[model samples]
Each structure stands twice: as C-alpha cells, then as structure tokens.
Target: MDVGLLLLSAAVLIGAVVLTATSGDRRIARLDRRLARVEQKLDAIAAGVGVELPEPELGHVKALLAEGKKIQAVRAYREATGADLKEAAQAIDQLGT
Candidate 1:
C-alpha cells in the first residue's frame, strides 16, 4: 500500500511539471508572435510609408457608440486621428462589436 501511494504521488508530480512547462511554452510563443508584429510595424515606419496616426481612446469611442451616436463617433475618430473615412468607419465598426 505504501509503495502504491508513492508511485501515485510521483505520477501527480510529473503531470504537474509537464502541464506547467507546456503552459509556459505557449505563453512564450504568444509573446514572440506579438513581438514580431510590433517589429513589422516598426519596419514599415522606418520605410516611411506607414500612416502612424494617434490612436483614439477606446473608452471614449465606446461611450459615443453606447449613446447611439454612430455617425458622430466616426466623425470624431476621423477628426481626432486624421484617418480616412473608410479607416474611421472600420475602426468604429470594430469598436461596436
């Protein structure tokens, strides 16, 4: 009975270690993807073809949308960030969801 209990405890410990290692690996992979995306954006900026506009506060946009001011929200976003009509519309659409 004592030997059985010891084997069970060892198995549980090994399982926990494997679970932790896999989770850590997943987290590292996610971070690496995010970092790569950021690097690509920076490269675009360095190439002088990137339209780096100031991002609007999402909270304010959400408030405007919640107040049922879709047009106003799009206009505010465009005016504040110098984004084109299509870009502003897309941004507002994303926020709406």
Candidate 2:
C-alpha cells in the first residue's frame, strides 16, 4: 500500500478506537449516576424504616495484610464488604498505609 493510504488507514483505526472509548466512558458514567440515585433512594427508605446498615468486619483482611499477603487481603475485603475488585484493592492499600 502507498504511504498516504497507510496513513489514512491508521488515522481511521485510531478514530474508531477513540469513538468506541468515548461512548463506553459515557455509558459507564451514566450507569454510575443511576446507581448513585438508586443508592440514595434506598438510604432514604432504610432511614424511614429505622433500618441501619451494619459495618463490615475486616479482621481477617487485616490479618492477611499483617502477613504481607496483599492479594489475599483484597480478596478477604471483597468477601467481607461485597465490594468490587478495584474498591477492595484500594481499601486494602489504604489499610496498609
């Protein structure tokens, strides 16, 4: 292929990637907002019913951290809190610090 044709093809590929990423980001952001609203509503309902959310126990996770087993700590945190992988990892990292 000619240099000009190759350059055009590359530009098109890059544009497609950018478009896909942008749309995906927007969709994720939208979902996050929706989730926040739902959580707020749930919180209000819980408060109205005098229902209290219990704090998750992280003793095992802390023990794992003390043993220098970060991955296992994250796993334990996730199991304890039902947090996603990233949230669990971040929480474990914060505890380590």
Best by TM-score: 2
Give lDDT tens digits, candidate 1, residues 23-58. Answer: 999999999999889988897886797566555566
* Weakest 10 consecutive residues of candidate 1 by summed lDDT: 50-59
Q: Quickly count the clashes in candidate 2.
A: 0
Please, what are the lDDT tens digits per residue for candidate 2 over residues 38-80?
9999999999999998899889999999999999999989989
**Per-candidate local distance difference test:** 0.87, 0.95
Candidate 1 segments exceeding 4 Å error: 49-97
Candidate 2: worst 10 consecutive residues by lDDT? 53-62
For each candidate, how many residue pairs have backbone atoms clashing (under 3 Å)? 0, 0
Off by over 4 Å in 2: 1-3, 85-97
